[model samples]
Target: MLRRSAYKNLQQRASQLQLKRSASQSVASIYFPSEPTAPVLKTESIPGPKSVELNEELGKVFDNRAAYFVSDYKQSIGNYLSDADGNKLLDVYAQISSIALGYNNPELLKTAKSDEMASAIINRPALACFPSAEYGQVLKDGILAAAPKGMNKVWTALSGSCANETAYKAAFMYQAQKKRGSLDFTHEELSSVMENKAPGASDSAILSFEKGFHGRLFGSLSTTRSKAIHKLDIPAFPWPAAPFPKLKYPLDNHKHENHAEEDRCLGELEKIIKNHPTDIAALIVEPVQSEGGDNHATPYFFQGVRDICTKYEILMIVDEVQTGVGASGKFWAHEHWNLTTPPDMVTFSKKFQAAGFYFKNPDLQPAQPYRQFNTWCGDPSKALIARTIYQEIEKYDLVNKTQEVGDILYKSLDTLLSKYPTKMKNLRGENFGTFIAWDFTSVLERQEFLDTCRQYGVNIGGCGDSSVRLRPTLAFGEEHAKLFLGIVEEIFLKLYK
Candidate 1:
C-alpha cells in the first residue's frame, strides 16, 4: 500500500529504534548480566518486616534513625538496591552519590577478592612513613591517572572533611611561608604558636559561599554554610560567608537575570575579602553545591571568581566531593567552567573512594617535615578499589555512556515536570550526567514525594529543604532512566491527579 521510499523510511526508523534499545540494554548488561530488568517489590511496604526489625535492633548499637531501610548489599545489583525485606528498588541516590560503578559490580568484586587487595587491607602501612613499594604504582595507575588538567601532585587524606581541612592547612601554611620568606621563626612566633595566637597560629581564614556544604570536621565545618544541624553547639571559626548566586531555572529564559545575579554575588565576594578582619588564605567552593541544594552557576560566574581569587592572591579550592568521577558529564565538574587556569587545589572523595586534594604547586607542601604528618596518610585498600573503579570506567567508556543516558533522562524529565509546575519547579542539572534535581512546592510535599518514590520501589534522596536529587551510578543506563521516569510519573499521577 506504500510507495518504495515510504516503506524504506519506515524500515530505517524501526531499525534505529531497535539499535537504540539494544545499545541501552548492552551497557547495563555488560556490567551486570543478572541485573533485574525492573524493580522487584516483594513486600507490601518498604521496611515490611525484616528491615524494621533489623533497624530496631541496629538502633541499640548504632544510630539507625536515618536508616531508610536496612540495605542488603549482597543482594543489590547494578542500579537496583535490595532492602532487608527482599525489596529490590532502583536506587538513584547511589549511597549519597558515592557508588561510582554499581552495587556488587563483578570487576569491583574481583578487585576486592584479589591477593593485592587482601595484603593491603591486612598489612596496612602507615603510608607517610612506611609506604609499600607498590603504593606509587597504585596511585599512578588510579588517582593520578584521573587527575584534572594542570594537577600532577596529590596529598591524600582520610575523608572529604579531611581533604578540605588539609587543603585549608596547606593554603594557610603556603601563605604564612610566603610571608615569612627566608626568615626563621622568631622567638615571639615560636612562643605565640604554643598559645594558639597570631604569627604562629595564622589569623587567616578560608572563605566559603553561603548555602555551600564543604564538610563537618572542625575546620571544614567552619567553611560549611549548609545546615545549622551540622554546626550546632560546635565551636566554629569566624570565617566570612559570601553569597552564592541564586540563579532562576529554565536558564535560557533568565539569562540576563542569572548573569546579573552572578555579577552581584561576585561583587559581594570581593567586598567581603577586602573587609574581612583577617587575611583570607583560601576560598573553597563546590562546583554544584550538592548538599546545599544542587546550586549551579554559569561558566562566566566561575571565571569571575577565579579572576578575583587570582587578583587577591587567595588560593582557590574546588570541592568536587559529590560532583566528581564523571557524574557531571565531565571527570571533574569544574571542567565545564573552562577557566583560564585550573583551581589551586581540587578536593575529591565521594565517588573516587580515595579522598585527597590534587595540586600542581609543590610549594603547597610544608617546607618542614612532620608539619603535615599523619599516622595513616591514606589507605592502600581504598586506593586499590579506586584503581579498579577507574580501570572499569575507562574500559567501558562509562563517562560518555553516562552523558548519553543523562541527555535522554533530562529531556524526559523536562517534558514530565512541565505538566506539574505547581507541585514542583526549579528543575536543574540539564546537561550534567545523572546529577539532576527538582524542588517541590513545600518541605512536606517533598517528603511525601520521596516517601511515595520508595513506596513505588524507587530509592531516591533529597537535599536542601525540598529538593529531590538524582545521583545514580555511572552504570545507570537508558533502561534505568526509563524505569525511574515511569515510576516518577506514576507517583505524580497518584499524588497530583
Candidate 2:
C-alpha cells in the first residue's frame, strides 16, 4: 500500500486545493482553507496605503524603518504570509526562520485558546524559583523531548543571544572553577570582579570562528563575526578568533579544494587556541552558518575542531539557534557530524520558541547559588507551545517528511539555478534539507530580487552581502516549493532576457 502522504499527494493532483479543504490534503489544505488562492496586487507598490498608514502611526513610538509591510497574521495561512496591502505571498523566510508551524496554525490557535495557555499567560512564573507543578511534564513532553542527543540537563533563557550568553557563562565559570580547585573567592578577586576586572571577572574567552553569526548581545556579539554592521556600536569581548572554512559551490564538484580549505581553517583554529594570549575557555560554532550566507563546513572539519577542543581542555558549544528543530532535516544539525562524544553545550532558540542550553557536564553548573540565576529564567507559556510543536512534529513525522520534500525542492532549485548561471552562483545545501541558499553577483541585485519576489507574491529573504537563503518551515512541502520555484523562474526569466 502507498503511504498516507503519497495518497494525499495523489489526491491533490485534481486541482489547486482550497484553504478549507479536507484534512487528508496538504498542510495548506487544513491550516489555510480560507487562504487566498494566489497573489492579488491591487496597488503599484507593496507598502501601499494601509501599510504606510500603519507604519506612520507606529513610527511615533517605535523604529519603523525596518518594517517591510504590516502583515495580516489572521489572513496568513500555511506557507503564505498576507500583508495589509492584501497581497498573499508564499513565505519562504518564515519570520526570519523563527516560525516553525507556519502562519497562525489552527493547532497553535487551539493551544492558545486552551485554559492552560490562558493561565500560563496571565500568571507567568519566575521559572527558576516558582516553577509550576506541571513544569517537569511540560519539559519532558516538549523541549526535553527534542533535546540534543546525550543532553539530559537544560538551562532556559529569554532569547538566542541570551541562551548563548548563558552557555558562555557556564563554560567560563566551569573553566575558572576547574582552575581554582575550590570556590574560595579571595577578597581581592571579589573586589576586582566588582569592577569587571580579571581573576574573578574571567580571563577566559569564548573562541569563535569568523563568519559565524551567534547573536547581537555582548558575549554572543563578541562571538558574532558575520557582519561588522551588527557589531559597529557594540562593545565586544577581546576574544580569540578562528577561521571558518570557505567551501566552494556544488560541493561534490570541488571536494578536493574544499577538503584542503577545511584543513587550512583547522590549522588556523589550532593555532588560535594554542597561541592566543588569553585562555580559550570554550569554542562556539554553528553547524551551518545560516546568516553567513548559509556557509557550510564538512563533518571532517567539525570532527577536527572537536578533537582540538578536547585536547585543549576547552568546552565546545554548538550554537543551534538557527539550525535546530528539523531545519537541516536532523533534530539537531550536529547529529549529522557523527561525533563520538557530545559537545559540552548546545544553545538553541528560534524554532523551538523557547531558548536555552543543553549540557551534560554537571560541573558546568556553578557550585554557588545565584550564579546561573536570572529574574525570569524562562517562559512557561512558550514551553507549553514548544511541547505542542514537538508533539505535532512527531505525529506528522515532519522532520523525515521535510527531508524527502527537501530533496525534491533542492533538485528543483538546482535546475532553476542552472538556467540563470550569471544571476545565481555557489548554490549550496544539497543534502542539508531545505536549508539552502545561493549567491547573486551583487548586493543590489540580491535586494532587488527579494523585492521582486514580494511583487510575485513570495516572501523570501537574503543573508550575507549577496546571497538568497531559503528558510521555509518544516510544513513547507512540494506544493509550496513548486510555487516558490515558479515565481523564482518567472523573475529570472524576466531579468535575464
Task: Identify the candidate with maximal TM-score.
Answer: 1
Candidate 1 clashing pairs?
A: none
Collision pairs in model 2:
19-32, 19-33, 20-33
Give residue 345's lDDT in candidate 2 (0 to 100): 97
- Candidate 2 residue lDDT tens string, 187-260: 88899999988766877889998888999988899999989988998887899778888988888899999999
Error at 60, model 1, angstroms: 0.9
Instruction: Give model 1 RMSD, 1 decimal.
Output: 6.3
TM-score: model 1 vs. ground truth? 0.95
Instruction: Please provide, for model 1 over 40-104, each residue's C-alpha lDDT reduced to its tens digit, 9 standing for 90 to 100.
Output: 76776786799999899989999878889999999999888999988888899999999999899
